[model samples]
Each structure stands twice: as structure tokens, then as C-alpha cells.
Target chain A: MRDGRAISIERVSKKFCRSLRRSMIYGLGDVTRNAFGIRSRSEVLRPEEFWAVDDVSLEIERGETVGLIGPNGSGKTTLLRMLNGIFWPDRGEIQVRGRVGALIAVGAGFHPLLTGRENIYINAAILGMSRSDVDRNFDAIVEFADIGDFLDTPVKHYSSGMYVRLGFAVAAYSEPDIMLVDEVLAVGDRGFQVKCFKRMGELREAGTTFVVVSHNMHTVAGFVDWVALLHDGKLERFDNVFDGVQSYSRLFLGDGDETIEKLTSGGQGVEFRDVTVSSQKLKPGGSFSLSMSCESREALEDVEVDIAIYDTRDPDLYHQATNSAFGQRVDLPAGKSSLEVEIGPFQLHGSFAKVAVAIWTRGRKESIFWWRIPLELLEAPHAAGKNLVPTSFRVKAAE
Target chain B: MPPSDESRQSAEVVVYRPDNSLRRGYFSLWGDIVRELVRNRWLTVQLVKRDVGAFYKQSLLGIVWVVLIPLITVGTFVLLRSSGVVAVGTMSAPYPIFAVLGVAVWQLFAQGLVAGASSLAMGGDMLTRINFSKKSLVIAAMGRTIVSFAVLVVLVAACFVFYGFRGYDYTPTLGLALAPLSLIPLLLLTLGLAFYLALLNSIVRDIATMLSVLVTFLMLLTPVLYERPVVSNDAGGIASALSAITEYNPLYYLVSAPRELVLSGQVADVGGYLIASGFSLGVFLVAIFGFHLTETRIAERV
Candidate 1:
């Protein structure tokens, strides 16, 4: 407790009590019955309380950038609010050493009836800025928000994007010792999102401690030094950014496949049976092969079997071909039969997905099978330039 | 590495560390509260200004409504006096003037009580975001009331001129100058009661709705529109008990002090004012203490 660490939470737990009775009966009947001594089982039933945030212990030092990543309802926002002292935990202690700034929900303090200019002052004050401080920073906030004419108009009339921009501008310029950002960067277009991340990077360099919660793995990987993964109101893993992301991706991808399988079985008739990949025996940046097989019970004809290969890093479909275009057809013999397809010379250094399937019949098109087979493309040692796979193999080195 | 290059290399190396300590203490708590309040001063001013501005925002009558409502109330009482429905007492000033002054002072107490009680609950958003002095909330509510009361005072003064009645000679005497001084304790008491009620209303929402009903009945117990002395003189069987009740009534003394100095052109009742001030101060301290005790749990209830 004597060091310059900015935040510390020890054995914190919060519980909320919920009643089982409906509002119509319980709300009105409870008032009347409780006034008298008439006790009923439903009225006297003790409230069932569950801890929303379980025992969580963590320490954040000054000038550290931490990323919070998890699925929705993982108590990330709750923990941020607790750090800001917005909600007190039922048990344990939290100590914050400096001025804490939180943008848990952008535009949370904006009133619909108030004009943007008025709301700036009001919201600034709510964020712990004095009147003089707001006056000094007002121009910069407005400039960053880029809302010139709308500043004097009621915020209710502004578009959702404008609300987010204004909220972000005010919060970013607040310049507190510690800042908590929660999923606000996902708002607006891709360009604005990039600008926000860049600005956050600048702030991170200026000795500001940042606790960011985002589902965007790329942003988390690029920006944060450390990451904490939460699951079902518990901190599942806390580690360096790369390791945390790897663990998260594995958990996320595993869950995603299970959920996708569930959706596909629900009256889609199409299923992904198996998927596999191949590459040149050895050497980095060498050619690679991908293969997928599908089996169907019914015999199919005049089907278009398409294979789409995409680099997971860029998520762009680099190669695509159909069996019809290649003069091939799937004429299965009545019962279940398998179809196999292969591709090669994969020239990427990241994971690639092999999406293959056969499409037949209009309106109620039946999928013979689909597979999301993964392929790892290695970089060739000789590949030097951007988009480095050479058009012709003719090389001479000075000896 | 060269000296300059070594320094440049050191600058690029990022250090990752964690701090785990609490800063400052209770004596500096007030500074933190002040900083939070200053940051949110805009919200406080806006809320206070809105309460004042809404009185004259869009209506054709605008600010006149403030004067007109009390004037109309006095007009109704005047009609009752003219029709002989009620006996008129002989006084140094016109009956309407006396009645209107009583109404003006009563409005201060009522406004202070209602607005102060509802202040924190009304600004629930601010309460959850940052911690500030709860006293500022009461101050904002009182500020709104004071603004309206000041406007009303000017109107009351103008009415006195219109009726060709010379304004009471207000001099800078030790006693006469202390007329405004009497209101301090009363203000404190109202703030305390208001804070207490605001906290209570958060826990028991029904209290807010029931307050208006309670206030209406309480108005009868206070001698605001009519003179308590007149009622005491007329009572036959319960005269002593009725007079005792009227003597001890807090509002009776609250109204009497101002009326004595301003309209009647006499020194204020010093003994009566002091006793009332003491009572108000006592109530204020108790109410504020109760409010602070209950405030920690208000967010959960709200």
C-alpha cells in the first residue's frame, strides 16, 4: 500500500437479491399485506441473492495498459464500474490512488433535453472537471468531436454517431491518471475506429494507465501490454497480451464451432463432415495444399461444388473455383458417397480457411457438405517484397 | 553504445509495473469532494437555473405568474373579508398587505422543504457517477428558492408603491439590520429536514407523494394567512390551550419576526426570534446527521 500502484482490488464480491413474485401481485399486495400482520409464504419467502462479481483480486500499477477480454456478460463493465467507485462491493476492499476516469458507456450522462454545449459542461463536471477546466478544454473537445453547428442543439436531435463522437472527445481529453474504456471504439466507421485506436495509443504513451475492455482481438493484441480474460463473472486467465489472446481465441473458436454445428443441424440439411490441409514437404514460404471431403445420403447431379480459400489474417478470399467451371460433376451413386477436393501453392504466413461445399437446386438449395478446414501458410525464405510470391523463378546472386 | 545512443535506447524501453497503494487521508477528503463538486458545478447551476427559468420560459405571463399567484390568493381572502364571511381585525397595515407578506414568507419555507427533500433523488445520475458533498445538493435547491423569493420581494415592494403606501423606513440599526439574520437558522433547519426526507424518499418512494398531503394539513396548523393572536382572542373554552399552541408554533415566530420589522415598523421580537433560531438549528443538525447516515445505502435502494 506504499507504492505508486494506481488500483488494487482484494477479495471483492457483489450480491444482488431478486424476488420471485411478479410485480402486479407482489408490488401492490406486499404493501397492503405488510402494513398488516397477515403473513403468506410467497410474501415471506426470503430473497434469493447471487454474486454478480465473485472474489476478484488484482493490482494495476501506474502507466500500465491492461486489456479486459471476454464474452458478453463476463463482468468486465461491472469491474470497471467498481474501480470508479460507482458501485460498492458487498465484501472486501478496493483502493484507487489517483483520479480515475471511466467511459464505461459513452454518452451515459447526456440528457436528451440539454444542448450539447450545456451537456459538455454538465458532463465534464460529472466527470470531475471544474468549471474553469471545462472552459479551458471546451474548444479542444468540440474540435475533436467535429460537431460545429450541432453543439447548440439538443443532444436528442443528434445522430447516434454524433453522440458517440462527442462522448469520446470529452472523455479522451479528460486526462485523468487512470482511464477505463469499454467497447466504445467499436462505434462509428472503420476509419473512425482506427483514429480512436491511434489516439488511445498516443494517450498510452503519455504515462496514462488504461484499462480497456474490448472483444476485438486485433485491437487488444496491438494495443495492450497485458490482458485479463473473464468468464461468467470470474477472472479465468490473466497474462501477457499474446498468451491471453491465444487462450481466448482457442476458447472462442471452440465455442463458435459448437454453436455453428448446432445451427447447421437445425433444418439446414448441410453438414461439415471433415477438413484437411497439405503443403510442400519442407521449407518456409513454400507451397501448400488444402483438401475437404463431404458425404451426402441422396444422389446429386448438376451440382456446383465451389472451394473458397481465404487468409485468416486479412480474411480475403485469394482463390476460388467451382467444379462446374473446372468441368467436374458430383454424380453420387444413390447411397452415401464422399467427394474430395484439393488446392495448393498457398503463399501466406498465417492461418487460412478452406470453405468448400456443393450447391444444387434453386430456392431450397441443398448443401452436399461444407467444411471450414484450416491451413497454415508458411513464408518462403526467398520471398522478399510485399506480396512476395514471385511471378517467375529466375534468380542470380552476386558471388 | 555511444552516450547519446545509449540514452535514446533507454528511452524506448517500456517498463511494465503494478502499483498497489491507497492515496491521501480523511483530512483531505473535503478537497476531493470540492474537486468533484467543481467539476459538476455546471450540472448544479443548470438544474438551479432550470428551476428558475422554467418559471418564465415560454408562458405569455412569464415572471408575472410568480407575483400573480400570491396576489390571487390574497384577492380571494379580500373577497371573504368584504362579504363579511370572516371578521376583519384592525391592523396598522391594509389586510391584503399583511396577508400577502405572510404568504411570501410561507412560500420560502414550503419551497425550501419540498425542493431540498427531492434534490438528491432528482439528480440520481450525478450521485452514481462521482462523489461530491451532499450539502451542495441542498444548497442548489435553496438557491432556486432564494432566486424566486427575491423576485417575489421586488414585486411585493412595487405593490406597496402602487397603493400609495410609503415603504417602511429600513434603517441600519443593530436590531433592524438583523432581520435577515433570523432566517439563517431557519434555512439550516429546512435544509436538514429536506436532506433527511430526500434520503427517506429514496428508500420509501411513497413518502414523496404523501408529502404534499402532509404539507396541506400542516399549513392549517401554522398561522400563515391569518393572525394567531386574533384566533386566541376569540376562543371561549379552549382559549388558554389554543394560545399556548399558537405561541409555540415555529411558523408563528418565523412570520412574526419579518412582519414586526417590515410592515409594522417596529423592532423584531428578540427573545422569540432567538428561541425559534435555536429550535431550527437543533432540528438542522439532527436532520443532517440522519441524512449522512442513510446516504450510503441510497444507491442500492434507488
Candidate 2:
């Protein structure tokens, strides 16, 4: 009940039964008990039931935009639905200030046989817009949706992109105090997504609190002021965007050292050990140094080393530095040999990246040893696209 | 308590908690329903417009089905009556006009109950996604029944004109104007049962299928198509027992009151009609209270 708090969720939990028959039976029992004014045992778990959202508490202030990001079945949607009041929590309480416009499913109640102009009113009404509110914003909504020629056509005839555009436009124009947006933004084209983010930015400036659930980190990372990371129906971290994204990336990729043994199988007597980095973290325009020791059973001449860096979000090889590529040569004596590779002042997209080190013979055909190192990326600039490159923008008068 | 800002701020803040049934005060829950229904009145209208428009738009027969259904039923009953296969027993107005009028009023309840019972289940997709007042869907389902009944009223008017042209003593009175008022009790009762059925049907769909059959059987028990018989031993054991059941059936009073007013300009039992209306109002109030209590959990079960 604090001033300026838009939404306060206190230790909320919601459970779902797996078996359909048992779920229905339990629903009947609970409803019957509810009818009699008896409190149902909401705190206890029944058979075939599991908590979909467990002991998650969050306080969202006015005008703050918080992102709910987690993998599939990670309770992000459940938490969003609870905020929207579609599913009341089985335990604890949720207090919401002002009106909530939930874009849980865009075009949710639109009759497919109805035309776009007709459904605009229906969808807006469902989103909690009064009649006059829709009337005032009707033209703006249509202009924002930008499905001009197809506005008179039945929504069933419109493309999926057009349908989503109209739906998002109505909900965005509803002028709610709190907006709950799900992954429905993924349906629209790139231009429409940009328009939506711009509209959301405008709403944020007007002090509309937002709780958005999206798996697209590139989208969520740019827009959200803070991120709540969830894992397996539990809230893992609620922190700034970088910390939460790094934790989410770690969860997604699993422990890095375990994959080293499986990734380096065909080693020829030279084992790469103690692969250490100068710092585990680096900014986009900063460089990091990696050094490793190679133990060889026999002396080898003209050996080569290669270090490949990959963005952890998308594990495609981003950049590689090789001794041969740099016109350098390496010679490894019998026992212990040390090597250093300075890997970048290069730019990357996500908050975490991984580097793989490999040693090759003179022919560059056979590998001597390989190792993987996980790196923490910092201050990666958010942009419209996934690429975060060092660039500058200038504005000048057109002469 | 602060006076001016308290009401406005309290109105703006919404608190959602578990076990709502225990927290709700009796009078406040009633107030909440009225406020919510008033607030979402436009949503109810839109749902009705969407459903009714989509229904007719998709059907090739369109509005003709409204008149055709009662016509076909009346036609079969008239044929049976003419062949001496059935006994209607001393009707005041023409049998065709009488039967069609009964069907029109009876359908308002039957179709409304069926529609309302399935409203939540049919809109399960939207129900789970959005958080609008659930009563809007049930009330909007009743809107379709109103439209269908309005269309059937035209058919009933045609029955009166057709029978009147043949000199069958089918002259109507000013009571026809007040005829729709008699259906208030029937509507309230049907809506009350529909609220209960909708909640149950969302959990176990068998309630809906079972209700359709039960409605058909109840139609036979109520005197919708025939006159109410006195409990006499000479009518046969089953007939007497059915007449006995009809005497206690609330639907008989609800259906016959409006039909008698429309046909003869007076109700045979004014006391029975008043009692039935009062009973329906009580059921409606209690059922709505129960519905409002647990509607928050419906999205999950659905």
C-alpha cells in the first residue's frame, strides 16, 4: 500500500493439476467449497498438482518497465497472467493500482467473421476502453495499425500480421495505467515491432507501468528498465538487465567446464590445461587476454594455435584469431608449454560469450589440444538489430 | 477516513486475493455485480453483436431459421390434432395461434438457458486470456435469445392474422402489449439456472449435454403445447400423475401467465404468477451472488 506503487505482488503462488480429469474434479471440489463460504486448502498441494508459479514477489513502481524473461515453462507467462488477473493466485495477494491493459493474446476476442473496423471496437472494449475513449482514439488507432485498404475486410481474410497490428494498436491506445504485454509482439513485422516499441516508450514517459514477458532478449533488454529472471517456476534473479541476462545465459548454456571434456575428444597427447583469462568480464570496446598451458608427451615443431570466440546467446562462431592467420609460428618442446592469445577489442551482441582454444600442427589439419572458456560480456549496446558494432551517428543540414 | 479522495482512490485500486467468497460481504457483492455489469455493458453489447452477426453471416438460411423452426413444430402438431391423434382439450384461441405463441415464449427461456449454459465453455479461449467481467458473456448469450424471440413475435403476429382472417375468434386485446412483461419471471429464472449451469459446465461438460435433454423433457411436463389438465382418475394413471406434476411446476405458471394474457386478456391465477415472480427474483439474486463469488477462478478451470 505504498504511494507511487503501481503493482505489488506478495509471495504469490499458483498451482496447476496435470491430469485433466483430476483437475476438473479438484476444480469442482474447490468451487463447491467456495460456494459454501469455506476456504479451500490453497496452500497445500493435492495429487497430480504442481506449483506453476511459486513464492514470487515483486513490487513495480509507477512508470517502471520490468521485463519477465525466462525459458519456456519457466512461469513467466503465469506471473504475467496473474498480474492481468486472468488467473488469481492460489496463495497470497496482488494489488494493482489503476486500470490494466493486458495484451495476453492479441486479437483474443475478435470475431473472425467481423470486419476490421467492427472488431476494433470489440477488441478495444475488451481491453477496457470506454466507448468515448475508443471514439476519440479511433482514427489514431486505425492510422497506427496501418491496415488501410483491408480495414473493411473481415479479419479472417486479413494476414496474421495485419490482425496482430490491429490488436496491438487497440490495446496500446487504451491508455491504461499499467500495461501487461506478452510475447504477442513477436508476431508483427520488424517495422510494426519498432512502432510498438516507440508507442510503449511514449507510454512509459507518461508513467504507465509495464510488465512484459518475452523470450526475445534483444527486444526485452532494450526496453525493460529491470529484468526478473525465472527458472523452473521459481524466481532466480531480479536485478538490472545485465545481471539477469548473464544469469539467464548461464542457465541456458549450463556449466561451461563440463562441456570442455566432451568438446575436446581427439587430443593427440597435448592437453590444454589451466586456460585462464586476464579478466572474466569485458566491455564491448575493451580487450581481454587468454593464456593456457599445453602439456605435450613429445616435442613438436611448427605448431599453430587458434582461439575462436562465440556469442553465447547464439553459439555461432563470431570471431577467430589464429597464429597462421596472423603469419606467426609456434614451437612446443616436450613437456610443459605456455601460450597467450589476446582475443579482442571486438564488439558482440549478448551479455555473455564463449571462447574455444585449439592447437594445430604445421599442416593445420590435425589438432593437438582444445579447450573452452566462458566470458562475461559487459556494456553491450542495445540496438534495433542483433549486431552491436562500434559506430557513430551525425546529423547535418542537407546542402 | 478522508472524505474526498478516499472514494476515488479506492475505486481506482483493485485488490485480487484468494478465497474471495469469504471476504465478500453480502450487500457489497451485490453492489459489485451491478457496478461491473454497468461498467461492461458495452462489452456485453459487442459480444452480442459479434455472436449474432457471425451466426447469421455464416448460415445460408439466415433469419429464416428463426421462423421456420416454430413453424415446423406447429405444423406437425396441427397435423396430429386434425387426424385425432392428440387431444389439446378446449383451447380459447385458435390452436395454431395458441401453439405458436407458446413456442415463442417457451423458446425465450429454452434457448437462453442453453446459450448461457455454454457461453463460458464456448468462449474458453477468450476467457482464459482476458479478464473481463464473466457475466457479460452470459448476459450477452441471453441477447441472442432476445433477438430470436423478437423474430418469432412476428411469426406469432402472422398466426393471429392468419387465424383471424378465417374467423376463428383470434381477436387480440391490449393485453398483447403487456404480454412481454409476463415473461420477466421466466427470464429471471432461466438466467439464474443458466448461471449455475455455466459454472458447472465449465468444469464438467456433461452438464450442458444433460441440460438439453432435461429441457426437452421439462417442455413435455410443462403445458407449453397443451392445456393443463385437472387431476382426475378418469384421465388414466399416468395422465393424472403428469397433471399433478404440472400443478407444482413453476414453469407452468411462468409460461401460461403470458400466454393467457396474450390470448384471453386476463390471467387465471394472479396469485400464482406473483409468487412465481417473487421466487424467480430470489433465485436470480442468490445465483448471481454465488456466480460472482467464484468467477475469478473460472479462467484457470476453463
Highest DockQ against the true fold, candidate: 2
Q: Over the stretch B109-184, how does candidate 1's per-residue lDDT look in tens digits? A: 7777888777767767656655445556666788767776777778767756655545543333454455566567
Candidate 2 TM-score restricted to chain A: 0.73
Candidate 2 runs further than 4 Å off: A236-239, A255-399, B1-11, B233-237
> Alpha carbon lDDT of residue B175, candidate 2?
82
Clashes of each: 13, 0
**True-vs-predicted CA distance for residue B256, candidate 1, Å:** 3.9
TM-score of chain B of each: 0.76, 0.93
* Shift in Å, residue B278, candidate 2: 2.2
lDDT of 2 by residue, A238-290 (tens): 56786777667657545433233326623677777777668866766678886
Model 1 clash tally? 13
Fnat value of model 1: 0.08
